[model samples]
Target: MEIGFEELPVMNLAFVIDKSGSMNAADKMGWVKDAFGIFIDRVRDIDFVSLVVFDSSAR
Candidate 1:
């Protein structure tokens, strides 16, 4: 089935990622950044995305 913007409801998405100690391990952070880049390339024009990364002691 074909879907159009006018026929669909608007959406808001929030991605909350943990940037704690573990995420800073070897290449793990890099991988996450790379994957996010790919995701942006694929969906940049299709939808709005908000990235929210948090650490153990901070927002």
Candidate 2:
């Protein structure tokens, strides 16, 4: 059995991203951004998302 998008339920997603100075190392920040972009692409239109970025702080 398989479930299609029409049968899927709404979702709520919360992402806590790390933006410390080290994140810039090895292009980690860029990689995370690209990965998150793909993740966002997979979200349903009715879903909700909250992104919190932190680096020795929360904003």
> What overall lDDT, based on C-alpha atoms, would model 2 receive against the true structure?
0.93
Q: Compute the lDDT of residue 55 as modeled in candidate 1.
A: 89
Report the error of model 2 at residue 50, Å.
Answer: 0.7
| Top model number, TM-score | 2
- The residue pairs in collision within model 1 are none
Separately for all candidates shown, the number of backbone clashes (residues 3 or more apart, or on different chains) is: 0, 0
lDDT for each of the candidates?
A: 0.74, 0.93
Error of 2 at 14 (Å): 0.4
Where does model 2 exceed 4 Å of error? none
Give lDDT for model 1. 0.74
Residues 18-50, candidate 1, lDDT per residue (tens digit)?
A: 898888778788988898888766553556788
